[model samples]
Target: MLKPQRPLKLLIIDDSPDFQLLIKTYLEDFGIVCLFATDVVQATSTAVREQPNLILLDIGLPGGGGLLLLERLRANLRTAKVPVIVITAQTTDGLESKARFQGAEEFLHKPVEKDVLIDTLRRVLSRPPTQQA
Candidate 1:
């Protein structure tokens, strides 16, 4: 008999420890393995090592911001096609457009509604690879 594949891995890149805890707790029931990174350096390294199925990125990371990291991720073949959702408080002019143009699957505002976050993630994950960024 063949073994079952593991559940998807998710990485959350945010500066807040509390938010990381909240995301972990909320997503645990979905059978996802959650990883945290408080800054770009760690986020980059973790992304390379873990190669998560999805990434929830905060725009205002320390060392390097989400946009920079997104660029780096897009530049790398291994991580370039991974789906990413930008969840951030900094929803300024054109940020969402920029995020989408930079290859984010979605851009969600901070204080994300629990249902919205879960639903968006589910929808994104369910789509075919051709439809994903």
Candidate 2:
């Protein structure tokens, strides 16, 4: 008999260690396996290697930032359709619009409500390809 597969794998790219810890703790019980990257380079590498089902990206990353990473990921066929949720504090001056235009599935502001985050992830992951956000 085969073992049960996990529901989802999630990658979080953020510079704040405390925030990372908080998210990890908040999401672990929901059956999401969380992976962390403090910078764009590591995030990109992890995204390719881990092939997470979803990505929570922070806009203010070091070296390249989340938008740059989103561009790179969209250009790569292997990771292009993976649902990305932009979780950032910088939701100013069309930043959210830019993220949406860059192909992020959803843009979530920081200090994210736990229920909203989980619900958004669940909805995105549950949809079929044509319906995915």
Candidate 3:
């Protein structure tokens, strides 16, 4: 008999407890298992250890910022190819471009719209991992 598949795992790297709870609720509605990391150190360690299917990263995180963490994630072979969707409250010019340049599969604004978030997650998960140069 074929083995049962595991639930999809999504690592959420953000410093806000309220946002975490909110996002978790949204993702749980779709049957996704959520993991949390509130800082860059924890984020890297958890990501390396858990090997989540996807990552939702917040750009304003304390301890090193999300852009730096994104670079580190891309540099590490274990986490490099895991799709990242950057979620940020910041509206700074070029922030989205920067995240995209760093390998984020999608960029989302804060006060995340439930439908859009879910749709983006599904779309990103459905595609094959792009071969990194």
Candidate 4:
């Protein structure tokens, strides 16, 4: 269990104001710290400086999109091993597999349910940082 003295942090990179508020409020209610980045530039800087325990990324953004961000994160040694969960509005086939291949450990469609969000977070956070990869 994560204690207040050492909370698990999640960086959510999305362009939606409503989503930012909703996710932040929900996660904070359960003692998880949430950071917001509305764009690629901010997301990159925050990921480097804050070094959040997890990243929840949205694929549709103003700039190069979430896939590009995921690639960048994977290339950067500092954040390469951090678990990234991709969330998006699209429900196209093979999206999840592609996300995993591109370095996202999980994928969620838009309007993510509270229970699913919490469960995924807990499960991923509880896993060993480096498995037999």
Candidate 5:
């Protein structure tokens, strides 16, 4: 017999309320435990306090940006190993590489579909902790 899989905890760091709700609703059916933070402060606090299994971070934000948040997250010992999947509407040149270099485990453009989101989440989580970055 196999042990049941635990519900995956996810933190979504996006300033848009609509986007947050969309992601939560889309992922709820899969039994993932989703949390939200609308800005840099909230994101940072939540990342440390909640210690989510994965984070879906958006690039554009108020009071600093996702890159800054990512850097801070990486620096924090509490949440440093958490796998981060970068999400953004701003698909500027070299953004993906920049994110990866900053320790993002994966990158996904905004308006992501359910299947892609699920697949990416599983892929990131399945990787060993050392390989998450």
Candidate 6:
């Protein structure tokens, strides 16, 4: 008999309670354990402490913003290997590319549909982690 698998822990960094609730509902249905943080400070500490398997990040956060937190996460050894999917309402030029350049595995717009969000998460998490030199 095979051992039971542990649920994947997903950290969601977003400022909106509505968005958090929506995402939590979507992910929990699939047995993903959802953790949350509303701002850069909370996001940073939670991420380092929890060491989640993946992160769903929102760009426009209070405190220092999501990009800054992403950079810090990338720099930190504990959370550096975790995959990050950036979901944001901002449509400013080059934001997506910037997030990717800063180490986000995927970029998604706000109001992400359930199917799209699920597919993106699957794709990103399925890929092997990049080797650090």
* lDDT string, candidate 2, 6-124, tens digits: 55788999999999998888787777788999998899889999988889999999988889999998888778888899999985799988998998989898899888887887677
Each candidate structure's TM-score, on Cα atoms with residue i matched to residue i, is 0.94, 0.91, 0.93, 0.92, 0.94, 0.94
lDDT of 1 by residue, 8-68 (tens): 8899999999988888877777788888999999999999999999999999999979999
Q: CA lDDT of each candidate?
A: 0.89, 0.85, 0.89, 0.85, 0.89, 0.88
Pick the winner on lDDT between candidates 2 and 3: 3
Q: Weakest 10 consecutive residues, lDDT, candidate 5?
A: 1-10
lDDT of 5 by residue, 1-133 (tens): 1111787788999999999899888887778888999999999999999999889999998989999999999999998899999999997999999999999999999889988888888777778878975
Tens-digit lDDT track for model 3 on 6-98? 788899999999999999988765677899999999999999999999899999988899999999999999998999999999999999999
lDDT of 3: 0.89
Worst 10 residues of 3 by lDDT: 1-10
Global Cα RMSD, each model:
3.2, 3.2, 3.3, 1.8, 2.3, 3.0
Worst 10 residues of 1 by lDDT: 1-10
Residue-wise C-alpha lDDT for candidate 4, range 1-133, written one tens digit per residue: 4444677789999999899888887776668888999888899989999988899999987678898899899988788888998999988888788888888988899889988888888777777988401
Tell me model 4's lDDT, rounded to 2 decimals.
0.85
Q: Show how many residue pairs clash in every candidate, following the order shown.
A: 0, 0, 0, 0, 0, 0
- Cα displacement (angstroms), candidate 4, residue 34, comes to 1.1
The TM-score that candidate 6 achieves is: 0.94
RMSD of 5: 2.3
Q: Of 2 and 6, which scores higher on lDDT?
A: 6
Which runs of model 5 end up more than 4 angstroms from their true locations? 1-4
With a 3 Å backbone cut-off (N, CA, C), the pairs that clash in candidate 1 are none
Model 3: lDDT of residue 126: 76
lDDT of 1 at 126: 83
Global Cα lDDT for candidate 6: 0.88
Overall local distance difference test of candidate 5: 0.89
